[model samples]
Target: MPTTGRVRHAAPGLGHSGVVTVTGQLGEFLRARRARLRPEDVGLGALPGRRRVTGLRREELAQLAGVSVSYYTRLEQGQSVNASDAVLDALAGALRLDDHERTHLRELASRRPRPLRRPPAERVNAMTLDLVRSMENVPTLVLGRRTDVLAWNPLGHALLASHLDPTAPERPADRPNVARMLFLDPHCRDLYVDWDRKARGVVANLRLIAGRHPEDALLASLVGELSVKSPEFVALWGDHRVKPCEGATYRLRHPLVGELTVTQQALSLPHSPEQSVLVVTAEQGSSSQDTLRLLGRFTVTS
Candidate 1:
């Protein structure tokens, strides 16, 4: 095959402004992934002369995946919706996607375009609320799929969002979304010592959720708002990264306690998979643990 330049075709359902429809997510993801890989990275020799495109060309990707260039182009252009499992698996393998990215690719490929609908308001069940309250030493909060704080214990509120009213999470409309705060709120941005890493992780997890719930109007709105307000968010979103919400260590510079290192873990609820209890804990016998105890006492007294 000649390494001639090919005319670029916009993916179907992409607007002039480059906004992608729910069904266009698969193509957008594929394009993003393809742009990140080099011919050499995929065991292909560099073509002669200057290349016009980034990463692997369409023909190269198709050849690597053992598929026709036309078929792969159509799949990447959002014209082929009913891709077989084997074909998708082949594409996943060719892209060298990780477990989370592989799952996200499958979700995007299988998703059907649907009218956006406002999902039911997420709530923290009474039992979950009780559980949060019981963990006095551990800073804990219940977060919805969109990273909305459904409920938070006193220590959790003190640890994460002390500037906001302690009871703000009780109201659905006024609830603080951690994603929004990380990008839009200055306080939240200052909270993390490594804001860039934290921000990227949040966006990656949100991308995974967006793939899993394409019909979620509120999630779409949140993404749009962030894209408009935060250039960092726009860049991260365009990277097509997907990650599950999991445990990670963070160094927080709290206005009240100064600084503390804590590991934050998200445990999904069995009855409500979209909701997770986020617990922040410091290692036992560490100075950070002592600081947490001090903060817990301050939260109770104040």
Candidate 2:
């Protein structure tokens, strides 16, 4: 019933230094969420006398979720692996997690992390390539789960990474990663007018992906490389922010054409949860549209 000084997880496979394992992430998330609430916020009256803990204590949270304190404590300690859907739902309700956070909670509590076993190239989708080829005038890209550029239209190459090889995405071994570019590439640094905002959004999307697939080796490598290469990325990743890579407006400072603003939309590939089509376009009738049209004068055909 008393609040412990801090909860410690005992799950195996924790990485060295700053890498957060699945179980460690789960416990930290729970601790962080639990510490942000007040007893009064959840209809519990503040107890008299100086309370040593913030938010709902472990016992109080367990009671609200209809679980024994010991059971909930074990789950937080990463000792429980086969948590039922009912218990997860109860905890989600008790924690008041939104839809995205609820999904994250379920994934983190599911079981031990295991690498996805598939062909080396399963992350690449042929149809995604065909789709990007059709988007001749649009800056279109097909991104792997780890944010690698699986495919990109000529316009996309010109608009986003013209300084790099236009055919970089064609070679599996030499694919250009947008996230890596966002943080580590000097050209990419100069491209974004608001680098901080773009960097934060990129890290947030990566956080969501990391929670879903903690055992992805390529993803882990990318994170480690960025953490070492970019202090900005290290700071952002530690924040545990999650965001869908949906649609957003981006202001770009292109060296050739000066500045232009465009909106980017990411559409998940059907039947392939890890691949997404990233397309960027300017608003119709705006100067950005005209600039983009001039910029995308080159086209690619299948």
Q: Tens digits of per-residue lDDT for model 2 on 1-302?
A: 22112112211222333233667777777876787778878887776777788788888788789999999988888877788999989998998888888888887887464532222543556666778878887899888887898888888888899888887787888999989999988999999998898888888788778787665555666776787777788777766667878889989998877799999999987778888889999998999989888887643221
- What are the lDDT figures for the candidates, one per model? 0.85, 0.77
| Steric clashes per prediction | 0, 0
Candidate 2 weakest lDDT stretch, 10 residues? 2-11
Off by over 4 Å in 2: 1-21, 38-60, 115-119, 122-124, 298-302
Per-model TM values vs. the true structure: 0.93, 0.81
Give the distance in Å from residue 204's predicted Cα in candidate 1 to where it truly belongs.
0.4
Write down the TM-score for model 2: 0.81
> Please, what are the lDDT tens digits per residue for candidate 1 over residues 60-176?
889889999999999988888789999989999999999999999998888776655567778778889889989988999999999999999889999999999988898999999
Model 1: lDDT equals 0.85
Clashing pairs in 1: none
Q: Residue 51 error for model 1, in Å?
A: 1.1
